[model samples]
Target: MIFFRSLLVAMLVILSAYTAVVVGNHGMNLLTVFFADMAAIEWPGQFNLDFMFMLALSALWVLWRQGISLSGIGLALCAFFGGALFLSCYLLVLSVQTNGDVRKMLLGRHMPAHS
Candidate 1:
C-alpha cells in the first residue's frame, strides 16, 4: 500500500500543474465553460456531473475526517478545490500512517475496535 505513496504524490503534482495551466490560460472563464457544459445533454456532460458529485463526496469525506475543527474545515476546502489530488494524497498519507491498518485509513481514526 505504501509503495504507491510516491505515485499518489506524483498524481497530486500533475493535477496541480494541470490546474495551474488551465486556470492561467482560461481564468474564470474556465468556470463559465464548466457550468455551461454541466447543463448540456450528452454522455460527457453526465460523466462530468458524476465526477463532480464524487468530488463533492471527497470534500465531505475530508470534512468528516477533520470533524468540526478549523484544520478539518481547511482540509475540506482543500478537498473541494483539489479534488482527486487532495484525496489521493490524503489516502497515501493515511496508508503510510496506519502501517497495515486499512480499516483505520478508510474508516477514519475513530474506527471502532472489533469486539
Candidate 2:
C-alpha cells in the first residue's frame, strides 16, 4: 500500500511537471494538434489513438466503480479528458478514503462491513 501510494504520487508529480512544460511550449491547443496528427496518419497519431482508447477504458472503470451514478458520469468525463492528471489525484484520495485497502480502492466499498 505504501509502495502504491508512493508510485501514485511520483506519477502525479512527473506528469504534472511534463504537462506544464508541454502546455507552456505548445499553448492550450491540444485538441487541434491531437486530431491533426490522426488525420496525418503518422506514428504520433497512432500513439494518440491508442492512448485515447486507454483513457476511455479508465473512464469506464471509474464509472463502474462509482456504480454509474450521475456523479460517476461526471467523473468519467474528467477521467477521459484529464487522463492521468485526474486519475492520480483520484487514486490518492481513494487511498485515504479506503485507509490503504487495495481491494476497496480497486473495487470500491460496494457492500457494508460485516459486524
Candidate 3:
C-alpha cells in the first residue's frame, strides 16, 4: 500500500510537471495537433486514437463504480479530460480512505470489501 501510494504520488508529480512543460511549449493547441496527426495517417495519430479510447474506458469505469449519478458524470468528465492526472490522485485518495484495501479502491466505497 505504501508502495502504491508512493508510486501514485510520483506519477502525479511527473505527469503534472511534464504537462506544464508541454503546455508551456505548445500553447494549448492539443486538439488540433491530436486530430491533425490522425487526419494525416501517422503513427502518433494511431497512438492518440488508442489512447483516446483508453481514456473513454477509464471514464466509463469511474461512472460505473460511482453508480452513474450526477457526481459520477462529473467525475467521468474529469477522468476523460484529466487522464492519469485525475486517476492517480483519485486512487491515492481512495487508498487512504480505504486503508489500503485494494479491492475497495477499485470497486468503490459502497461495495463490500471482499466481494
TM-score of each: 0.75, 0.91, 0.93
Across residues 46-77, which tens digit of lDDT does each residue of candidate 3 receive?
99999999999999989988877899999999
| TM-score rank order | 3, 2, 1
1-115: candidate 1 lDDT, tens digit per residue: 5457777888888888988898898785755676677788677678778888888888888788667788888988888877787788788878878874777876774588781
Worst-scoring 10-residue span by lDDT in model 3: 106-115
CA displacement after TM-score superposition, residue 49 of candidate 3 (Å): 0.5
Question: By summed lDDT, which 10 consecutive residues of candidate 2 come out lowest?
Answer: 106-115
Provide the lDDT at 28 for model 3: 92
Superposition error at 16 for model 3 (Å)? 0.6
* lDDT score for residue 39 of model 1: 86
Using TM-score as the measure, which candidate wins? 3
Candidate 2 runs further than 4 Å off? 109-115
> For model 2, what is the C-alpha lDDT against the true structure?
0.92
Candidate 2 residue lDDT tens string, 72-97: 99999999999999999999999999
